[model samples]
Target: MTETGAAGASESPRPRDSATVMLLRSVAEPAGSGFEVYLLRRASSMAFAPGAHAFPGGGVDRRDVELAPGWTGPSPQVWAQRLGVDTATARALVCAAVRETFEESGVLLAGPSTRELVADTRDEAWERDRRALLDRSLSLAELLARRGLVLRSDLLCPWSRWITPRGQPRRFDTRFFAAALPAGQQARDVGGEADRAAWYAPAAALSAWKRGELPMLPPTMISLRQLAEYTAVTEVLAAHRDLTPIEPELDRVDGRERVLLPDGTTHPLR
Candidate 1:
């Protein structure tokens, strides 16, 4: 496998733990049309995957696992089993997914109680807290405690794990999770690292990618490819998935850089 950097000179960077959320929702479109998935385009000035369409996520913060907010659904121990990690790490990963999703997309996978979800987060106070969460002034557990809310951990389904190719300036060992867009909640352009945010039917997004309009990393495209197969959010959430970790192998075939995987898949470098 090719271990040379993109420039064929630099050494590989160590991968950092991160988590991403695939927010899905059903559209009025017909069957086989597939469900919609939210995506954000990173600002061009960013250091990693700039200008690439991606899901909302980021590196795990040490404080993420410290939150003791009320939680419903599967416990951290259960997540550890599903994510193939220890309980502490699993707790952090799940919290990171929820926190990053809210920070980037303004969608909260939380509620006042397990039976209901927060309908609107457009209040000035909510924005203040969101910013505090992003700026590290507040931990999610602390924020939830102040609001008497609980994280609806049941909303998330562990989907996949993807490690960035070995030779890159920035690499992430990212866990991908899927969640249905909460009812009464809508996504908006929150603008930070990402300049634009929108939702697209999975098939449409794939078509855009093929047309060279929606550029994305291999993992994003692969996740979309999988999502394009399902017609509804329920279908995706209910389907059994193999959550094995996948760290794409880099190789130079016929003098062209490519990403190879054990599943007999290959994607040429852009």
Candidate 2:
């Protein structure tokens, strides 16, 4: 393996339980409003995708899945059973999503409402945990407990799941979720993982990528394409409200990459 490849292989991004939350909002287009998803540009110091924009997410932790005080969202047992892991892991995945979103974007989904958190910026202490969490000195669950916060599963909705190709040096069995950009909280690239952040309409973003303005992994590209199809955030959430987890397989064809869903449909990578 090349040095870069070797480093990527050891990059601690192994297929540990994880989840990504795609915070979206509706913006009025000149003609009508449509869905706009948020993306973050990784800080140049990062090992992977040093300058690429991505959704908020990271590796799951043991405390994330602890059921002692798990939030009511998806069934932990069901998710664990589906992902072929223990119940605890499933909960951790959800917790990771909530935690990652907050730490990376400086947005809190834990409050009663988005506006509330924005109204009261006194909870900046949670920001300290962002560095500590990545540094492995603290877990998200502990952070929330210390802050008297709860994981607002109700704000999150299931979207899709994707696993890295089996032969890749770094792999992730990632769950993607969709959540409304909370009203009061603003998304910022606070965590060092990302240096900058912005929101974009899926179609507009993909168009720019096509023109070489941005680069996206196959899964994220396709996910954005799918997201661009809806005109309203509510419609998109209603459509996926009862999502049946469908993981796609990646294949190389015609000197290009393709995303092959288990259902037999295939889409070309942009």
Candidate 3:
């Protein structure tokens, strides 16, 4: 049987959850199709997906399901039907997606001059406060409440969802979302979970990886390949307007190191 990364010696299982987010943007390039995607290089100290470029996201929090206000995107009922969960859960997941994105990326998705968001984005004061909050295990809900802010769920558009392949020590049932880059807001690596960050044309990023410089999980790789087909963010956003969400199950080949896609195709990992 083909082996995997540290699987033979490890007997314990890894934890997983259905949560994640991808941040995509459009670039002002000379070419017509100019959508560029943002990717973060996780710090080497991370237990999993180390040194891999990924979007800013993580698992849902208990508070995310609480459903606060200033959100005006998809109706909870619409998300409930699509997410295959109760309206409350759907709302929480959406909240989690936005909140996680903020925590991991320092990109705030919120509404009103609730004291905190306004202060955080005004020149990194809020960012400093947020960093402290993250270190203290403070809930995003607490932060919002303390600062009089509302989660702006309207900014996030549901894109795609992916589940990690079975047999992976760490698995994730990730949901991808796209947001237009906010005006006057630029992204930085924030130097904790992510050591570095960059923006690249989707097609260019794929080509670079083909040349073997970048690392990508199956879902991220496929998403970039698909995003490469479009030239602008408008096209990509338009494609998902129907809000058709895809949930793919990853199947691992028995006694060998290979994974199968729904198309009955297989790929091997290094």
Which stretches in model 1 have alpha-carbon errors above 4 Å?
A: 1-11, 31-34, 253-256
Which ranges of candidate 2 are over 4 A from the true structure? 1-14, 66-86, 112-123, 241-270
Best by TM-score: 1
Candidate No. with top lDDT: 1
Off by over 4 Å in 3: 1-15, 66-70, 113-122, 241-256, 268-270
Candidate 1 achieves a global lDDT of 0.87
Worst 10 residues of 1 by lDDT: 1-10
RMSD to truth, every model: 2.4, 5.2, 4.4
Give model 1's TM-score versus the native structure: 0.92
The 10 consecutive residues of candidate 3 with the worst lDDT sum are: 1-10
User: What is candidate 2's lDDT per residue for 152-219, written digit by digit as tens?
Assistant: 66677777777764445556788888888777666766757877788888888888778877766666
Clashing pairs in 2: 64-92, 65-92, 114-184, 115-184
As a whole number from 0 to 100, the lDDT of residue 34 in candidate 2 is 81
Report the lDDT tens digits of candidate 3 across residue range 1-270: 334333432443443444566566666678445767788888889987888878788777665665354554567788777666688877777777777677676677775643323323536666865686567466676776667677766566677766665446666666677776665566666778888889878788788778778776666777788778777777776675333433333343455555455665555442
Q: How far in Å is the alpha carbon of 45 misplaced in model 2? A: 3.6
Q: TM-score rank, highest first?
A: 1, 3, 2
Residue pairs whose backbone atoms clash in candidate 1: none
